[model samples]
Structures are given as structure tokens and as C-alpha cells.
Target: MPLKSTLAVPITDDPSLPVVTFRFWLISFFFTALGATVQQYYFFRSSSGTYSIFFVNLVSFSLGKAMARTLSERKFTLLGQTFSLNPGPFNIKEHALIGIAVSTGAGSAYAIDILSATDLFLGYRINALGSILLIITTQCCGYGMAGLLRRYLVYPAEMVWWSNLVQVVFYNTMHNTQDFQSIRLIRGWSRMKFFWIVTVTVFLYQFIPQWLAPILVYFDWLCWIRPFDMNFWAFFSSISGGGILSLSFDWTSIGGATMYLPLSAQLCSFAGVIVNYWIILPIMWMNNYMGVKAIGKPLTTKLFYEETGLPFNIKPFLNQDYSVNETLYEQGPPANMAPMYALGFMTSFMGLAACCTHVGFFHGREIWRNWKQAVGSDQEDIHTRMMRVYPEVPQLWYAGFYLVMAVLAAVACEFYVDLRYLLPGKPIANMTFKCYGYMAMSQCNLLLSDLKLGHYMKIPPRSMFVGQIWGTVVGCFFNYLTMILIINSQRDALDGTKPDANGLWTGQRVQTFWGSGLIYGALGPARMFALDGKYWFVYYGFLIGFLGPIVLWALSKKFPQYRWWSKLNVAIFAGGLHNFPNGYAMGILVSLITALVFQWFLFRYHKAWWTRYTFILSAALDAGAAFTGLIIFLFLGGGLSPKLAVNVPSWWGNYYTPEGDNGPYLAVDRCGAANNAWTSGAEL
Candidate 1:
């Protein structure tokens, strides 16, 4: 096709390597559980905690390599099949499997949120078995859809899904080290040696944010400034979203992501974030557009209930009848959404319309043509051709995963929410879409990496499929159990409606999830689009959001001269719109800066330095971040109450939200109560 990059990635044509050995299984089983446990355990914490997949990859590879070096290949017969405890060597494929499993928890799953919501708020007791199955259905259902789209997403050479490029560079640099000639420009050791050295150093350095001075994770200079206006404070101080200074010290939060995203996508998303969250959100809320007063309640559900004159009384409303209580609903006015929430929703709506239009005009014909040539010669690509010797994973296999998830989903949807009345169909669908959106996206993106890795190492495509499929399936089991334990242990603290005793356990993310469920399920976004609705502008978001891409496309076609015009990706803007400045303002800024410096500049001119150091540096950050998160959970107040753990002193960093570990009292107004919360920080 086009000339390959100036940066060279040497590939291995060798096929014989140990993937599923005793060491592989041993490490996979243990870490998969550990990662899942670590993932869910931190859900109750005040910070936005998540395990890094880069961390997982590094750890898994190290373990796998150790096993290869130590354990001898002992061949044995089991049943009728001959097997070896250690096959040949620690291969990328097996390491990829472990990374795949850990990455399963890489996305925001709504099922876990559903578990927390019902248990914490609705008080619906879904037993352990039901809880386990519920996660499987919602999480696994997307794998099947991904399997079907494999040829489209995985086969195409140009479909070099940008995020995977980082992992690819790492995997190749480590596993195929012989090819990387040591250019004696400015290095001490080989790339592999340098990588390990950096990884170890950063791991040690992670303790700053891990257990000691957790406030180091976030920095906001303007947090000290106050006549104590909650609205003004929200713009600068709020860590969850909307800010001018978001210097997230946590590598997992911002550093690693900066190294992975493509330059174009990063630029587009950054522009969108500034336009929406920084500029328009303040202007709209300050002027009280459509009476939208939502700074005191940043997460928006409480504001919604108060605006509608119905503050959620779960017991009275969550009756035996699971149907929407129109009589109860009519007792108050219609629901009012927060500006940010409404914005995210409107962008989501826009995304739906824009994706259809963009895909139809751009890729519809190509896809349709490909579908017709199911097994035709057109299916060939350089990677696919190289992998042709390996057998293909039968579509039937993917279909099987799909069918199992569907049956479990149906039962889970029915029993998980209610027993006597059986939960309504809409909530089940809502949670499924919610979980599947992130699940499919994260997992499918993971699939792209696997394909590239497989191609590099000459792994059988079918074999790769088995590893990912089984890995995800196993991950769901532990993640669900972890959720169950966390929910049972801290019922009161995890409830967003109430305050945790020492702000140790805010369940902030789940609060958002629970609120999102209510919005999509009970008080749907459609109501906001109604003629007399308080959020009439939400409809305009969809209309405007839809038009943005159409205009760009029309311009690109009409002029055909400005080559860069077509590259203005609407998907990036739609994604950026859905997740605006508020949710990840500081993190986005960090990524933009990093991308601009390294990706935009170094990649363009100093290509050798860019290729040599970027991914290794990123991996170091991510590995350190993961270790930090795990240590925080194991040692610090990951789940323990403030009585048992050390709390960081109240400072500007922790003053953002009450859910933060060292946080001061939040800036929320009580439901139709006296407006005194903005004063004296948490009534202290």
C-alpha cells in the first residue's frame, strides 16, 4: 500500500512458542482473579481508581519469562493428549492472554453498577448466583458481536487501531529484541534493558501517590480561591470534570493514555473538550439557561429529583409492581437533568445519528461489498495472508458465546431487578447496552492488539481467538464475585444518596451509574426532548451534533482541495462531546500536551527518538500506576474506614469532592433546603 514508517518494527516468523503452559495457566488464573478483585475492591473508594492494562502486560510478561527461564519443558500425557508444562519459551501469545484477561476489567461495566444500585438504593436482593450470571451475560454478549465483525475490524491493514500501536511496540521490542540494533546515540543498554530499568524505577516512585500523600494524584492551584461559590469552585476545583489545571500525577489517569492515542484523534478530542466543557458549560449554567442550577449537585441525579419536586424515596416507589408509577410520577413535575449529564446524553444521541450518517456515506459501500464476498479472494490482507496457514476460529464458536450470554442475560434481566413482578425489560436492555458499549469497545480494541501480536509472532488466528474468549469468560466470574463481596461489606458507605462517615467510601462512580440508570430507565432522556420540557435544548444537541459531520463531509466533497478537511473526524468530536471537560478535563489536557510534544513534534522530525523512547516511557508510567493502585488498596484506605487508615490533610487537592480520600466537604445544595452547604466546607 503506502511506504512503511521510518520507525522499524522487526517481526518474528517463528511459529513454535509456548502460549498455554503450566506457568501461563498458573499466572493467568492467579492474576486474573487478583486483577478483578483489585478492580472491584477500589470501586467504593473516593478516587477514580482502575487497574492499568499496561501494568498487567508488564507483570504478566515478567512472570511468563521467569517461568520459561526456570522451568524445564516436561512432556506428559493427560487423558490421550500429550502436553508439556513448559513448551518451548515464554511467548507473546501466552503473555497476550494474561493481558487480555486483566484488560477485561479495563472498561466501566454497568452490571456491577446495577448490583450496587439495587442493593444500595432500590434494596432489591439479587442472590449470589443471579449476580454472577448477570455479569456474564452483559459482559460476554459483546464478544459474539465482535467475533462477527472480525473480518472488518481485524483484517484490514489500514485498520491499525491506534491504541494498540503502543502495546505492539512494547511486545515487539521485548519479545523480538534481537532485531533492534543498538544505535549508540544516547543509550547505556539495549532497549529491553532500558525498558526494565525504567519500569523498576517508576514502580518505586509510585509510592508517592499510592499510600503517602494521595493528594499528589490530583493538583488544582485555584482550589484555594473562594468566597466559596460552588459554581465557581466547580469550574476550577472539581476533579471529576471541568477544570483549567488538571495535572493528574497518577500515570494511569493521564500519562499512559497520552502515549497511546493517535495524533489526529487526540487533537480533535482536545478541541471538542475545550469548546464544550470549558466554554459553553460555564456560560449556560451561569446564565441559568432553562433554570439549570446544577453546580452544588455535580453528579446531577439529586438536582434532577429536586428540580422535578421528587427526591427519590425508594421504598415508596419501588413497589412489588416494577412498572413506572405514573400516579407517583405525576405527583411532581417532570425530571430536570444537570447541564453536564444533559450534554453527555445529547452527545450520545448525536453519536447515534452521526455514526449512522458517517458510516453509511463513508464505509457503507465497502462493508456491503465485503459482506457479499464472504469467503472471496478480497478477504486477503498482508497479516491475514501470513496467518492463513493457521486455522480460522469458526463463526459457530462466537455464536456459541453469544447464545450463552443471551440466555443468561434474559434470566438475569428478569430476576436481577425483581422477583414477584420480574424486572422490566427496559432496564435490562439499558444495562446491557451500557456494559456492552464499554465492554465491546475495550475488548474489541484489545482484539486489535491481539491480532497485531499474533501477526507479529505468527500465532494462529484461531488460537488467538480461543485465548481471548476464554480469558474474558474467566475474568467475568471473579469480577462479579468481587462486586458481590464489596456490596455486602459496605452497603451504607457505597450509597451515593448518603454521606460516608469520613468520606472514605463515596461510591461516586456507582452513584453516577445508578443515576444514569434512572435517567435512561425510569426518567428517560426522551422526556427532556418534549415540547414543554425543561431541557428542550437537549434536542438541539442531537440536531446540531448530527449536522456537524454532514457539513464537514459536504465541504470536503465540494472543495476536494483541502486534504485535511476530511480528517476532521466526527467520531472523535462525538466521543469528546459525550465525555467533556468535566469527566476528564485535567487528564485530557495532560494527554493533549504529551501528544503535542512527542507525537506531533518528535514523531514528525525526531522519528528515531520518538520510536525509541515513547512506548517504553509510557509502559513505565503505566506499570508504576498499576502498582500504586494495588498498593493503595492493599495497604492504604482502599476499602477500610477512616478509623483504621490515615487520611491526607485537608488541602486544595482534596477539597474538590467529598468522595475524594482527603477531600473536604463538597459543594452540594440540599434538596429544596437552606443554601448553606457552600459555606464552612461540609458543615465542618
Candidate 2:
């Protein structure tokens, strides 16, 4: 690895240590369930917090140690194998496996997004069996690719997959605590103790912004200045307008990735956000370009009717059979999205194109060389040398598992496709096709990263394979179950009947997915992006994204003195900008500040403190926010007690009558007039 100093991880191994034991299975399953529950539950929320592996690591450590101490190490035989209730002492390998399992299980399946989009927006539902098969297959289809590429991506020491190094360092930290000394930031407190303290503190504090006094989530001071002025509200209100200085204090709003991501990446994303939302959106709305002013806001993800400036009703555009009604579609105005939403799509287009070229220009040669060398070279790093003791997982095993999953996916997809025209479900076919095709590559990259983590930890390849499969299987079920529950209970919020008061249950993510289906499936790109169509200009994002990096690459080569040009990543910038339009306007400002503080200032100035506690701090914040948010949903938001729940005393902070609706004129800041300020050109 180029960053050899960071890779000074221990290379020693004790093969006698048990890789999989009774405790391993127990802790792995426990964490898989816990992680999945938390992740899937939060997946639909506006400020969807993650149940990160750092949180998993800490909890598993305590659980593993406790099991070792409490459980009798009595040996037992099962299916021709010997096992013990407790493993020899919760070694690093077992700890590493638990992390792997949780990481595999915690991600809400990508297929769930497709499923939820169809269920909520398109008003279609898959049978439970079909849903299960779809999720499992989509998740596992990437394993074969990962196995095939493992020689190039995993075994090679140079293919560092830099992000994995953080987790590897953390594994060593928690397991080998005595090697490091406690710092004065917390004064003699160890990393584990510090993590628990922060987690507990954040858990208690999250209630203020999450439940009680929710106005603080997006503390828009400027909106308070001219609360009733429609023009000012349009310009400054965080909820309905350009989110300038509007900052969210909640950790969930400011994602934990800020702690680790490079400052340059954050800055690039911020630049995109500034250009698209702050500048372009306002200009477009003012000029009424593409009838954007008719959409009622300069920046929102909601789809709108071009004529009425109201929510677009897909029912009108569809025939009785759910297929596009050519007569109605030709007669009605095309579906309109907010200007920012259009730009957001442009960002996605740019991101995809930029990603390919960026990789080619930057790392393509190195990767090609690595692939060639991986097949022939005998060279090895210390970690790779130590890892050789464990018998590698057979390629046939991965290929077999992948073939089975792919077959299952094809069958399920065929079943769905067969229902086209018989049901309003053509989108399901498109979504499934996209999911299996795209997710396999995405999942392969993820699996490769995890494999690298295993490589670093000297985990037995077979144990890694077994843990990944088990965890993925567990994740599929929990992800589906959680999606079903959320769609059932939060149907009103999800389907736009009754939006959540505190902005927690917006379903904007699935709404975005559904919007994509409308464009790609219902509307079709030919109609939406035609030369004379409204979004034709958006196709140019591809050109911009593709050529932008090549220009930067030339500039870097020409002016080597400007070292920063080489580091600038246009793809990251595009991806970051693409993410900002997902309902949290204040998140842009809050997350940028967080990145500067955690990744830039802290790392540059206080290296010691940053090294010891930064990742733990990030973990604690995510865990605390996740646990607190779940509790709010379960107990206060009617998960447990439907009738008695949500009985909070109404006040300015909790007054959540949506703007422009009947009940309340104001929504925490009396910005209702903003909704009426604009008129569709046809209406005008």
C-alpha cells in the first residue's frame, strides 16, 4: 500500500484461535438482527440515521467478553462437528467476523427501495414469497463477481480500499487496548469508556430535536425574521425555500461520514449545492424556465402538475390497466418536477458518467497492472503472508451460490414481468431488472471492501464467506419485514395522506425512487428528454460530467505545481450534490460544517485526539441518534400505543400544521404565504 505508515497493523496470527464457535454464531446473529432492525427502520425517515459498525464493534465486544466469562465452555457435537458454548476468549478473529456479519446485514437492501416505490406510489404489491426471493437474490448476486475479482481487488497489497483501514484500526484498538495509552481529552478514560459516555449523552439529548421542540432540527432563524412575507419565505425559509444559513443541530441531520471523508470531497459537494440550489434554482424560478415557477417551489423533490401547481396525480396519466393512456398523456401537461429536482437528476447523470472517466483517468492503469500481477506474482506483504495460513474459500463455492441466487432472481423477475398489463406493474419489471443488474456490481464492490477488511484482520476466508452469507440471509428477511411494517403503519405519511409533524416520516427516499420509475418507466426518456422537451438540457449533464474530469486531468498534468487539482474529485462532488435534494435543506450547511470541524480542523490540529476518539465519536453519535429515534417512533409516534401516542402539548415548537394546509396558518414560522406566492404561467 502507498500509505505504508497507516498499514503498520499487526501481522502476527495464532491459527489455533477458533474462527467460528457457539458465541460467534450467537453474537453474529444478535448483531445482524439489531443492525438490520435499526437500519431498515430508519431507511424511510427524513433524517435516516445508520447503525454503523463502530457501534456494532463496541456492543459485540462487551457481549463476547460476557459470554466468555459467563457461559460454561462445555463442548457439544452437532451434525458431525464439535463446538463450545464459549470460545477461548473472544479473540480478534471472532470479533472481526461479528463486524463482518453486522456490516453485511445492516444495509437495507437496495431492492427494498424498488419495492417500496412500487407499493406506495404505483399502488402495487408483490406477494410475500416473491418479495423474499427478490431481496435475497439481489443481495447475493454480487458474491460471484466478488469471488472472481478477489485476486485483483483483495489479495493484492496495493489495492488498499482506504476506507477499510479505519475499521481495521478500530478492530485492533478495541481488542488490543493495552498497547495504546489513554489521552487527556477525556483524561485517563479509555476509548471504550469514552464511547459509551458520548453515546449515552447523545441518546438523552436527541429527544429535544427529534421529539420535543422539533423546531431545532432545522433552526431557521431567517424565517423567523419575516415569518409571513411570502417573498422572503421563498428566499430564506429552510423548509420551503433556499436553505442558506439554516443549520440543523441534530447529529442525524449532519451525517457521521463527515468525520472521515476528506475535506476536499465535502467542499466539492458544497460547491455543487451552492451552484445548483442557491444560484441556478432562483434564476430559473424567477425566469419561469420550463414553467418552474408553476411548480410552487424553486427547490423540492415533489412531483407537480404543470397546470395546477399541485401534486401530480399519476391516476390521470394511466389507463384503467395502469399502462400509459396515450390519449390522456397527449392531452394533459407533462409531469413537472421542481427545478432543483431536475438539477438533481442532472447531478446523478453527471455522477455516473464522471465516475467511469474519473476511475479510468486516475486508477485504470494501476488496476490493469494489478490484475496482471495478481495472476503471476509471488510477492506478499506481512498481512498477506500471515493470511496465507488460512485455507482460502474455494471459487466453486462462490460461483455455485451466485448461480443459485441469479436463477432465483431471474425466476422472480419473470414472474413479475408476466404480470405486465394484467396488473399496473410494468414498473416492477423495470425496477427488478435495474436492481439485479446494477446492484450486483454495487454489491461486488462492497463485498470486495469487506474482503479487504478480512484480509487486514487475517480472518479465515471460509469463515468470512460463511459469516457474509448468513448475515445477508438474515438481512433480507429483516429488511423486508421492516419495510412491510413501515409501509403498513406509516402508510399515511408514506403515501402523502398525512405527513409527519416532525419531518421524520417523509418517505422522500422512496418518493425519489418512484419519481425515477415515472421518468424511466411511465413517461419514458424519449418523451421526457426529447430535444424539445423540458429536460433536454439535463442530458448535457452527461457531457459536463464526462469532460469536466478530463479537463481537470489535463490541467493537473500541465500545472503540477497546483497539487490540489489532482486531488479534486468531480464524481464525489456530483454524488454529494445529487444527495442534497432529498428533503433536508439544512443538511447541506450542517454537514459541511461538520466535515470542516471533524475531518479538517481536528485532523490537522489535534492529531492525537483525532486518532484516538474520532471514529468512536462518530459511532456513538449514530448509535445514540438511531436508538433515540427508534424509541420515539415506537413509544411516542404510536408504534406501541396508538391512541395515547403523539399527545405532546402543542406549542410553537411542536405546532406542525403543514404550510398551505387548512388547520394552521403557520408551520412553526408562519411561512404559509410562501406556498401561494407563485402562479403557473397557464393560470397567470
Candidate 3:
């Protein structure tokens, strides 16, 4: 099914179609804002806020709408022919497609971290101006790079199939007056009916675990103790455990933990899992356990630890505090948690290495190609090709604008926090002009590089610029504040064990801030980027991220028999499985299955059900999950707190003994100096 033929709404011969109404923009912006916020909150639990979504979504959608409106009024020309027309009030296809694409790229795992980190370090606080810049910078940088590479990735047809295009085309055609009569079964009511039925069914199934299971069911089943046996029963029983089990089962069987994989490369990842779980984990466990006597230290050894109690093995430390045999319990569970860390670290390291190698190779080629082309080389490469096709305003102009804006941003951030020395000799002003000027300029340079990449890729320059600027501005402001709130709230969970000026203390800050940031950043990228890169080969991984759909074009040349493969690729990539494990593999599998099933249905039953609804249905399901997860964390996960403290009882024996209390205990003040000893003679 060629998208252009199947979903293209024939442009009307008449030029009297009305442009999109303000009402349409308003309604669409609300929904897009709601959806984006829900997705962000869930994906980046700590950083995103309910309100942040409103502003970010409003800006992106409104800007997008405005851009579309502007474009609708313009006349486009190509190859000496005028392509003049009015795109009515909502080219439902184009706007929605842009929204979905931006959501996928920006809504994934590390987006929150990226936004939050930039805000904290760069000092962009959450506000209207900052929000605008954040969104534009991040989105533009990523999309810009992606767009520039799209010719090499998506246009090749052999490189990427971009399946989501089908859905956009289908919806547009259905809504367009000129095309509504072409498909008898896909009238307005029928389309609504189909969507409603699928949406309800998916909602019920997905919601069961998301809402009910957390409260009613125990997640202990997921604990390491049950392991294989637990997963086996869970897999066969319900969808709840089935999803997780699928991941675990696939991890073990596929050995998905292997080192770097190359583009269009095929290799077994299952072997790596086996080595890590069967060999590496055990060895690390044994080493830690046997060496415990030498390394064994109480949780209260350090002030940070004593104040927080061991963050990971809290229960064990708690057990030691209450139990008669304190030493045994302290050493037991602590050993177990170490293995999970080891596994996580190994996977993260491998993934990072793969990313570095992949990005390095592609960037090197790009640099060399640009140099050669500039000096008049023998032939033009992809970069030269992109520059010729999508020439932009000069780099210097953008650079200058970026610097001016970045400085303003920094100044605003400093003033907002009352950190006036950021401007020198002033300690209590909202923001000095100098700080704003510096930060804005710095951020702009970064944003420009990202945009340049987008321009080269031929991604609509407007979309790239809008997305990046919005993401960067929004992220720079809210990320740090959110981090502080989350950290302070989780303080009790973090502190080892100590009394502060106000009594006891919890050290959740470490975990909430640094620990979680590092862990999430590592794992999030690993699961998505690491797995996807293998299909493209490490050397060509950057191309996969940017130009994934282009594979369809390349493949079509050799395997004309599998023309549908191109369509399949597009759908999977467009729908948001670009970086998932077995994403490429499952893409091939699903495409094959769908093709066979569709062929049978179309030929024997004469129905276009699969062709019409699969992509939409998948997107809806994913959106549901994203929203549900967001709600869960916001309402159910935990609330923010200002103070930090742990109230747990001491393990082993109390290091301190009151003046009146007795019985072979040592007395030490909060400062760790020995005040007294209960025993007359203590063996020193």
C-alpha cells in the first residue's frame, strides 16, 4: 500500500477552501498539551510537572499551528512549476504527524533528565521566556540532525519504511471532503465507531494493571527471589506480568546485552545476557561476599550514610537495628542488591560505548565530507547533497542571535534565584543583565548546531526550530526546581541514619538527585538506543536514528518482491519503536505477519481493516500507557516534602548511651567523640 496513493487526499480543483479556524487551533492545542504533559510526567517522573506540560504543549502546538497557517497562505514552487493551494484550517494529517513525531523524539526516557540537567547547570528557570527557548533548542537539535540525515535514512526507501505516514494519510483522506466518498466503509461515523471500539478495548486491558494491580496485587513477585519460577507463571497468567516477563524472557534468550552491533547487522544478543547473569553476576556476588570481612563497615560509618541509613538495603539495615543478630542481616541483603547494580552498570557501559563509536564514525564522515566538498572534491557526499538541496540563512547570523538570547536567559535565571554575584558584587537581585546575556548566548550556539543538522536533513526547518526551542526553554527553567522538590521529599528514604539540627534525617537527596539521574540516563538510553543501533550496525547507528525509513528505498532495489517491507518499516519507525529491542526484528516479523494477514483479508474477505487501523490502534495504545503511567507517578508514587529525615530504629547497638542508661554500650555524641563507656574497662 503506497501511502501517497492510499491516503493522499486529492487537492480540490477549486481554490475556495477556508483556512483552519481559531477554534480548531484552540481545541487541538488543549488536547496536544494534555497528551504531551501526561506523556512527559510518566516518562520523566521526577522532572516534569502537571503545569509544565500546559505551557510547553501550548507553545509547541500553537507555534506549529501558526507555522502551518503561514505556510497555507504561501505559494510553493518546485521544478519550474507552481504548487499553489490553500491547506484548510487543520491539515489534520500534517499537524498530527508533526505532533506524534515530536512526542516520540522528545517524550522518550532521557528527555526529562536532559531538560532538568540543562536547567540546573545553565540556570534557566521555569518561565515563559525560558520555556520557549528550551523547547526550541532540544527539539531543533535532535530533529535538525535527524532531518539532515533523513535523506540518507528515510528517503532511501531501502533505509527506512516510516510506517506512521500511513496513519496520517488515512485520517487526512477520511476527513477531507474531496476523498470521503472514495472509501464506502470509512465514512465519518464508521471511522469513529472503529476508533471507539479499539480505544475502549485497549483502555480496559491496559488500565487493569496500571491502576488496579499496584494497589491490589503485590509487586514482590518481581523481586529477585522468585526469579525464573515467578516469571514463568506470570507469563502464562495475565498481561500484567506478561509484559515484564516478555522483557526478561527475551533478555535471557536473546542475550540482548552484547557489545556494539553494526548497521543492518544481525547478531545474537542472548549470549551476552547469559554471560552477565550466569557468570559475571555470580562472580561479582562471590567477590563482594567473601571480601565482606575486610570491607565490612556499619551503615553509620560516614555522616552521609549514618544520616541516611543504607539507601539500597534499608530493610536489612532496619532488620539489623531490631534483630538480635545485627551483623548477619546487615551482610545478607546487601550482597544481593550488588548484583543488580553490576548488571545495570555493565549494560550501561556497553550501550554508552556503542553510542560513542556509532556517533564518532558518522560525525567523522560528515566532517570529512564537508571539508572535501568545500575544497572541491571529486564527488559530493550526503552533507554536500543536503547543503545544496536545503540551503539556509548563514550560520553566523544564527550564531549571533543565539548568543544574544542565551545571555538574556542566564541573567533571568540568576535574578530569579536572587544569586546576584552571577553579575558580580550583587547578591540579592532577581537577575542581572550580564548573566542572562551569557547563558542565552551559550545555549544558542548549542541550539544552532542542532538546527543546522536539521536543515541538512531536510526535515521541515520550521518544525525542527520550533521543537528544539520549546524543549530547551521549558527544560532549563523547571528541571532544577523539580529535582529539589523530589529530592527533599525522598530525604527519609535516602539518609543512612543521623540527627540533624532538627533531630533525625533521611538522605533521599542523593538517590533522588544524582543516583536516579545517572541510573535512569544510563538505563533509558540503553534499552532504546543500544538495541536499535544493532540493526543499523554501530558504524551507521546515527544514520538509523536520523534516517531510519530510508532503508525501505534501498531494500526495494534488490527485493522488489518485498515492496511491502518498505511500508512496514515506515509504520514501525513512525509509531515509536525505533529504539526498542527486537524493534527491528519485530518490525520485520510484524510486517510479515500483517502482510500475510492483510493479503488474506483483502483477497478473501475483501476488507481493508488491517490496512486502515493498525497504526492508529498502536499509537492509541501507546498513548494510553504513557498517560496512565504519568497519572500513577503524580498521584500515587509519592508527594513532595520540604524536610529530610529517617525515623527508623538503630541497628546493632546504639553507638550512644544516655547518662543514666547502661549495659556494655559505648556513648558517643552527635559529633562522634566518645562521651562515656558503660563498661569500666573496654578492650581498646
- State each model's CA lDDT, in order: 0.60, 0.76, 0.33
| Candidate 3 displacement at residue 674 in angstroms | 33
* TM accuracy, model 1: 0.82
Off by over 4 Å in 3: 1-28, 44-89, 92-192, 204-207, 215-283, 286-346, 355-397, 408-513, 516-613, 629-684
Answer with 1 or 3, whichever has the higher TM-score: 1
What is the C-alpha local distance difference test score of candidate 3? Answer: 0.33
Taking every candidate in turn, the Cα RMSD to the unseen true structure, in Å, is: 5.1, 3.1, 15.6
Worst 10 residues of 1 by lDDT: 666-675
Name the candidate, 1 or 2, with the larger TM-score value.
Answer: 2
Best-performing candidate as measured by TM-score: 2
Candidate order by TM-score, highest to lowest?
A: 2, 1, 3
lDDT by residue (tens digit), candidate 3, 51-105: 2221222234445555557655556777996544444454443344334333333
Clash totals, every prediction: 3, 0, 110
Best-performing candidate as measured by lDDT: 2
